[model samples]
Target: MIDLAPHDETDTTALKERERFAQILVLFGRHGLKGLAARLGLGAGGGEPLEDTRPEAIVALLRDIGPVAVKFGQILAMRSDLLEPAWVDALSKLQDRVPPLPFAAVQPLIEEAIGGPIETSFSHFETEALAAGSIAQAHAATLLDGRDVIVKIRRPGIERIVDADLRLLRRLARVAERRIPEIARLKPDELLRHFAESLAREMDLSAEARASDAIGEYLKTYGVRTARFDWELSGRRVNIQERLRGFPASDLDAARRSDLDLATLASTYAQAILRMIIINGHFHADPHPGNVFFLEDGTLGLIDFGAVGTLLPRRREELVRLGLAIASEDTGGVVDILMLWAGDPDVERVRLEEAMAELIDRFSNVLLDQIDLADIFQMVFAILRDFHLALPPDLALVLRTLLTAEGFVRRIDPAFDIARELAPIAKELMRERASPARLRGEAGKLLAALGRAVLSTPNLVGQIEKVARTGSITVSIAPKDLERLRGRERAGRGTPQLYPATLAICAAIVFSSQPLLAGLLAFGAVALAVFEGVRRR
Candidate 1:
């Protein structure tokens, strides 16, 4: 089971830093992350380090570190374009299951969040939790209005603990940036910022409720179902949503007994999700089997909106183009979409196109119905990483979501193909792109862009002309490099201060062991100091 023990103020105080450091060191060493420990400056003066590079060791290490770290691993796992495939594969297996806290621990929090005693607010509230995750616990409750609901309460004192962990994580990211040059391309600090942002959003139950409500309303348009929440009863720490009574999507036996058509259900799920991404530009980031329910009424119910992904309309269009390009073996088109998505990056166009060509060649011959979208996308991401191209967090999250959704669909129906499922959406997007209205929109956008460029041309020309005349340009120092330089300067300035301390230590050591040598050394030291001082003057 995962560790869910609450850490108090004492655990985050400066006094516990050494203990925390030691814990990190030991865990790292135990899990073959000793290289990281050494990079973090904790491996010296140690026993034989475990240097195993198994991906499982990495997952184990993250899981052992608790919720925040696990979430970090999850975010990293989704970044296939920034990480090795093995690491991504292993981290994908990290689960957030933790033992439930005793009912008494969160009882007061629930009452306080809804502003009353539990008895007064609910017709009946179960003391036993229905489920417990790392951050929160959900209880089966009936509202005072006699409606069934799920009461979710944040774990007491978790915010303080997560905040402390985030602080340490940022520090470690800085350390990694300074020490691990190879990992610098991953932009650890920037990644941490994304994680922290998502984490903060997740910590607020109200934000999740709103997200759920929005997605729920959106899903209804597609005839999909999700649990509705009582926004009035929801607060930052507490959420009361309708309780879902359905079997997990993976429960094929239950699905069959309920006369559910697995194929139709899978198709419905795929269509809804694809439309959510391609049309709505918002989707559930985590759509694994556990979070998906096959309701008795033949519709799927999505739960847990804590991790939602949103793409801009432009990005959605680009993604649609990317799909169609891959389908048609348009290598140049693939590279073009990728370049647009990746923004300004140092790219070898020929090499990237060649890689895309190879990717197309590999999957081109495969039948559409047999195409594995997740595998193809994974390979594309791998090649992107090879070329040092990184996807923004939004795109990474989208890819992660699609991959996860594919995994769930394939688990119960191996014959189900993600590419085949996405083809209709891709075709629709293509149709829309070719429509007269879209054409007018595109033409107008282009003209507006040209107008803006024309307006800025004089300033651009002036800057270029100035640069040409000056024959030189000043570049600002990077903060990381500046910090390193300052550190070196400090070390240089500290050398003289160490001299007197070094002499005193040497004298003490010699005097304690050999009085004759101590006396001679003391005389020599005093004479050298006097001569050096006179020379300086």
Candidate 2:
């Protein structure tokens, strides 16, 4: 188990650290730092900042803080659930461009991990790094057999810095859980822990190499064009992969100059992303333009597979159901999925229904030719956030990556219709649901479960009747069960207060006879009544 104790207060640099943290918060606010600071407990009275240059401020702040901060900004950029489109666009520019560690610092790490000196393993190894990033730097090297490859070396002691930051974050998450009642339902601490695990995996070069190989195998199985790594040359601190020479995905001018079909490229990417999620159940979690490349023949090369998301077979089925429900514009189906996925199943259904309706109306009715993938994804994200429906961690990352991929596609071709391409894939998934084999398997499982329950019903009824007669009974309740029950009770209690208050406000507004006020109140009254009814049920 991970110990989440607070850091010891024994640093001589305490004053400097505190001052730097304060400055960081201030800068974060400049990027809409006010809102970010408020989330971090640095704001007052819930008031807006006097000056707001959120976009430029955020860009400048990210540029100043180096890789980790820039990486954080990139994560935030993918969060259409937490931020607006304009901010997402600005934050997308937070590229991984740290200065490479000196060759002196890297050579030793490679030698230690590979159990040999650089000279023993390679015929030629460049002393200069080809590229640098937050966790590792890469150098061009030629193997003993003369095969060209890139050797990625993890920076020594970087893990300590990451661990310290994560430790502090976990502590802050605990404080938020205790003090910020409004956000408790979101499970910020759990989310941070999930991110911490992902970051930890990224710090291990061997783990990244493994992930790359796994994803590459999946891609090959699906007949998709993707790059693979040489795992034999990988170790704890070093990853060696075949190097490809191609222009980055963001270089649209270069692609146009090279006779690449922008629309076809966009469609290929969208289809690849959908297949990764629905069929393979695994995907690269970060698909920004910088990590993608386009070769002259138009084969897309995906690199940097450090961050990834995977869904269990069951979760994949549920996700397919959710996607189909959205495609069919079934608000009830969407609400059911949202409730099933939420920590609290007893959440206000009316609110969820309203959000779902808004989402379906916005996304489902848009003309296929006119639909923008980024906008559609943002709408879906907004609905999830408005209803406080937290997605499972891995699924959330996949969704964010999809949104980023959509943004990249849009940048490549303004007229590219991602949704139109995705619609067919969604339909195909729905068709798969109706396959005879799948249906039979589902039916057989249901029948078996029902048969068992029916066979045991007499004894169950007898026990219940005995308990009812004796006025005593026992029921086993696990810790998770208890938490779920408490969550339901809290939601139930909160429902009534909102309704009566809303009714009173509506009555007052009707008495005043202000048309706009009356309309607003009427809407609120209807919403409250629905909420109350759903809660009672």
Candidate 3:
């Protein structure tokens, strides 16, 4: 086990830590998680440690910890590589459903953020909240120019609350890493850093506004409808945007009542999402029923831009390669793509190839129309998990977004096949990959890498020569390996001591008349013990 070294104490730090600890303890007690608390060495005054980490307990813990923690859990839910399926399923249900703060409580903050009181900020502002979440509440309003909009007000004092909780979470992550051996591979610190950055971006309304504008522009280019954010009225804590009124995607009955064509809507929405991922390489990470709406004019409107994912050019290219390779049933191509995309060199090639072959064989016999894209993707992810390969954060989020989209679209039309839809996109991507411009770019990159390698060859060779001459080399082992080595050494020591002592005692009994044999056995025992002590030293 690793040590969780304590931080230096100060008046303010101590107070904040104490408050955070107390809140955690209380929440743990409320959720009957005293056992978990005890396991973290935060024993609930007088309680036993919980030996098992059940899925339900994890959900309860995150729920009671508050919004940021809840959000963290939701994000973690997508990380199948880091968690069991049951844990992921439980955490995926986290929602930001906190009760709305009273309008009076948020009014002052909104006025200050928007540079005026409600009377001057807008032509008409409602006191009642239209929607509420853990971080902010939305109210219906009308702009001075007579445009209907929604004003989202950040909860009073939320910034401090979230910030403090984040600090506590960082400390807790550290503790978890040290105390829980299994979690080290998950790199809790790095995961927390990513979570913190994502949360920070979410807290800034301007950032969300910028993301919305970028995504809106891209989607509009493809004739996909999206809401536009009014930057003039947006601030750090207040977001003003065009008010969207329509049947939520989840309301199937409402859609039918409006005589909406479910088939067309399903196809259009699926195509738009595919374009967002494969063509534009930027997408809304969360496209759940709650965030999607169908306008009266048949346009699909997506809201809640706080969570988004972007795919880099190379990563996008790799995904295209992966799809095409899978279609061809080429195990080597799949393996190459995994190595390049995930950047994990330690994966066992034979095992990965065998897994990919099995996956290909299973899917190859099925017709395109019969294949389920989401199931295929899940199988691929399962292979990666088995090999201890983890996708980059952006890729993981994009995959989850695609999976969610597939599920949502399929709900509208049971016969909808994402695989059939994706086939053409994959082929197009392959064609693009082989295009003159792309080939030239790839060739240039290859040459540059080769040039660097050639220039550094002599220096690399010199280092190897120097190391050989000095006979100096060091090997670093993982904690798990080191622990095993220690265990073997301990067992080896005990056997030597026991065997020699046993032999001496047996000799003393059997050779009582033979003084020489008895003496030899006793001497051997003493010698073996001394040799063992020296080896230990």
Candidate 4:
């Protein structure tokens, strides 16, 4: 997270800062949120005229305030778990489009970055930008070897502009929470800090280049690949990567006109992204139309790795369980998972369960393919809001990413079902759970834990003995631990004590005389000790 200078760390009283702060207030006032501005300590709190406060007005306000504000709104758009449909829709459609900066403006920086001149790296260069966003712009170019590449240059002087905006926003958030009681639910300060960190990652062109390499692949029929980067020429401010081939994924006309099988592509794209999220936990958070493409090679290509979502393995498991519970109409299970997510054990279980049962009943007759996820998400968020519980930020991001992806995928093939992907995904998830590799990993973990406990047992036993001596306490081992009670069962070569083990060889050899039973006896002893060690642990 970008650490903003507190009052003591920097000169908050600087004139340049004061001017920028006033300018932000003026921009908000111009956008018809003068009351909001006043509440944020911009002006007198009462007796102020404010214009339209509709969703569109909010979008316009952010866009007008510039890149930082626009990016913040874009992040908020992904928070369907916190926002109503109208606001999320309006903000989701909000674009961070800015007029391209002239190549002449960035030529000096590019030449210095490459340690020479543009001609030294590129034989052919297009001055015009391939695309322009709030943070950076991409230019098409060709290397001396006749390879097509894209050069993304961070906007010059953007750091200064963004730094100023962040400081102003931070100050405003601190005061707004106090002045406007309702704004506390939004947790403005934390959101602003997170936005700063996300923007910082996006602003670093080289970081975006590295992220593309880590993005996972889907089924062979399912998808495409990321652009290859040139690390030699890439840096924090400038990135050069091979250009990819594809039509924008959101272009329905292109999807229909091409020979590509929309049915297969739709499911593949849906499942591929879901696997990235549900299976691997790292996924492209912003899969909006502009960031995804249907490749000329008959595959779905994804780009723009600046924003991504991550789900913890534990959370992913809960999600799977929640999905299963919903599908099976296990109302109690659904309520249990929801309460766990809500993190409130004392919540009214009956009320939550009744609500889940109603939700399940509402969709019970509907086929999985026909159920509207958008509608379901809205109702669920409403329930969460009613209970005064907010969805975790990561889960919120997943919901938004899923909904965003589903929007474009359906645009290709309307009948394609996202729910259909879940069953297969869940099957794979179950298979993974029972896979031998996973079982071995679990066993190894258990063994390690038992080993640790056993190694520390002497110290624990000493403390316990001391405590027991203080009182006339009784100590007894349970029946399950009776094997451990046999302390004198030695397995040495010439030992007198009998080796006790369940193995037939040891059982027979100990009962009947046998010399080579040492190995079997030792194996049986260690196995029993480890098993009991784990049980005690």
Top TM-score model: 3
Candidate 2 differs from the real structure by a C-alpha RMSD in angstroms, to one decimal, of 12.1
Cα miss at 293, model 3 (Å)?
1.3
How many clashes in each candidate?
A: 0, 4, 0, 0
Whichever of 1 and 4 has more lDDT, that candidate is: 1
Number of the top candidate by lDDT? 1
lDDT of 1: 0.76
Looking at model 4, which ten-residue stretch has the lowest summed lDDT? Answer: 488-497
Estimate candidate 2's alpha-carbon lDDT, on a 0 to 1 scale.
0.69
Model 4 Cα lDDT, one tens digit per residue, 290-368: 7777788887777888897789988887887787779888776676677666565455455666677798899899888
Better of 2 and 3 by TM-score: 3
Kindly provide the TM-score of model 4 when superposed on the true structure, using C-alpha atoms: 0.77
Write down the lDDT of every candidate, Cα atoms only.
Answer: 0.76, 0.69, 0.75, 0.73
Candidate 3: residue pairs that collide? none
Candidate 1: where are CA atoms >4 Å away?
1-19, 29-35, 43-54, 417-420, 452-537
- lDDT (10s digit) by residue, model 2, range 331-428: 66667677666655555565566677776886666677786666767677777766667777766787777777777877877787755776777677
Instruction: Write model 3 residue lDDT over 98-136, tens digit each, in one string.
Output: 888888898888888777877786899899898898888
